[model samples]
Target: MKWYSLMPGILLLGLAGCQNFPALYSSAKPQITTEKIEQLSEYGAKFATEYNRAAQKTCTKYTRLYQQGDWRAGWVLALQVSATNNKHCLDNTAAIQILETLESQKKIDPELLWLTQVHLNWLKELEQQTKSVSQLKRAANRKQSRVNELVKENQDLVEKLEALKAIETSINQ
Candidate 1:
């Protein structure tokens, strides 16, 4: 009989401890300095100290979301951070494996499923474009190097021929 009374009080305490849930998704909290992206636009997405701080802050948010069992949100932040910042703070690969696992679970909300697919497709396309551009640059460099070597070889040959003709003229004299 005493245990029943104690249980209600204990349960209330437990529920009260979860009060931070509202804060987790709070709309009132102003965005931190590390969360802003406008500075990145000014820098043309180049490396800067601000990016490192933002990446670290984003990584922390991802971690907090994962700890709260909000895996989808965590993966979103991870992907955004990876795409926008240098890899010194967070890996550029992002939550690829997590999203793949999420894809297999048909229980996910339709909107999230669509969003994940979009990110995956975009990432894959970007990677392919980067690879193609790199290969073209490499080919261009190789062509220029070969052209320079041929020019140098031809110059050497011309000089040798001139010297041989002078020696022949001297012998005739």
Candidate 2:
């Protein structure tokens, strides 16, 4: 057959192999069952309730600290509460962000400000320590690998020595 005559057939076959055009062009909306929607709503309600409870408890503790005139303790408790809430409840990071902003604005007392700086420095030290620990762990791993290699080499040398002894004994006999 002539090339031009086969071109139309090749083009049609290529298009057919590309994708399912009917499914792609279908107008039907995706079906979501009512059971799944109900389950999602229930989960959302439970999560909201739990988050509210955690938030209320954190607020109550912070308020008590504030009323007791331990502003530094209250500030630290606020941080702890935020961290705890972030870990267990909704993942809101507003507490730290607000604290940092307030610190930058110089609104906190001098003692609390000093404590914040110390806390930041301590966090930096912790990061450095973690890095050092990781480096030590890697060094230990390398040493262990070297030890394993030395053990394997020693085992090979011992086997060779035994074989040499066996050959020497046979010759002597």
Candidate 3:
């Protein structure tokens, strides 16, 4: 019927009207400024430093746990620490790259430029530390796996030796 056809059209029109199509289609870009970039870089550096510090603490705790034979928990903690460190590196790298790009495009103040360079150097150091931590985590996991395997093999050997003794005792009886 005509009413049913009109209902669908009306619903479609109402749905379209509810959506802010103009806002979605607008081509306006956010204004970028040197001050904003500097602030962002500073914040990024602070965040990275905090994250790295926390990760280091976690790593230390897990290292102690690992020494105490809680390998599974230690391994999981190590992986989490590695991931946190990696994320810090990624975030700082992105902020540094953005600042570098801005510097190339516009004239940044000497103070801001110096600060950016300092942040870049710090991020680089963090990256190196992250890499070292990851390497150590991997090595520890490998060693733990080897130790687990040796313990399992020893248990099997002991069980087999017990069975052999039992058989010998039955034959003598």
C-alpha lDDT score of every prediction, in listed order: 0.61, 0.59, 0.59
In terms of TM-score, which candidate is strongest? 1
Ten-residue stretch with the least lDDT total in model 2: 88-97
Q: Over the stretch 1-173, how does candidate 1's per-residue lDDT look in tens digits? A: 99998999999999999776544465664434542335423332333334455756655655676667765554554455445434533332555555665667553355346667877677666667878999999999999999999999999999999999999999999
Minimal lDDT window, size 10, model 3: 73-82
Candidate 2 residue pairs in clash (backbone atoms < 3 Å):
none
> Candidates' TM-scores?
0.50, 0.44, 0.45
Better of 1 and 3 by TM-score: 1
Segments of candidate 3 deviating more than 4 angstroms: 1-90, 103-107
Quote the positional error of residue 68 for candidate 3 in Å. 53
List, residue by residue over 1-173, the lDDT tens digit for candidate 3: 88997998999999999887656464764456778667756644554455467856644554465457553322233223225334422254544454455457554544456655665566667768878999999999999999999999999999999999999999999
Task: Output the worst ten-in-a-row residue range by lDDT, candidate 1.
Answer: 40-49
What is every candidate's alpha-carbon RMSD to the true fold?
Answer: 20.2, 20.1, 16.1
Quote the positional error of residue 162 for candidate 3 in Å: 1.0
Quote model 3's TM-score. Answer: 0.45
Residue 119 deviation, candidate 1, in Å?
1.8
Misplaced by over 4 Å in model 1 are 1-54, 60-70, 81-95, 105-108, 168-173
lDDT of 3: 0.59
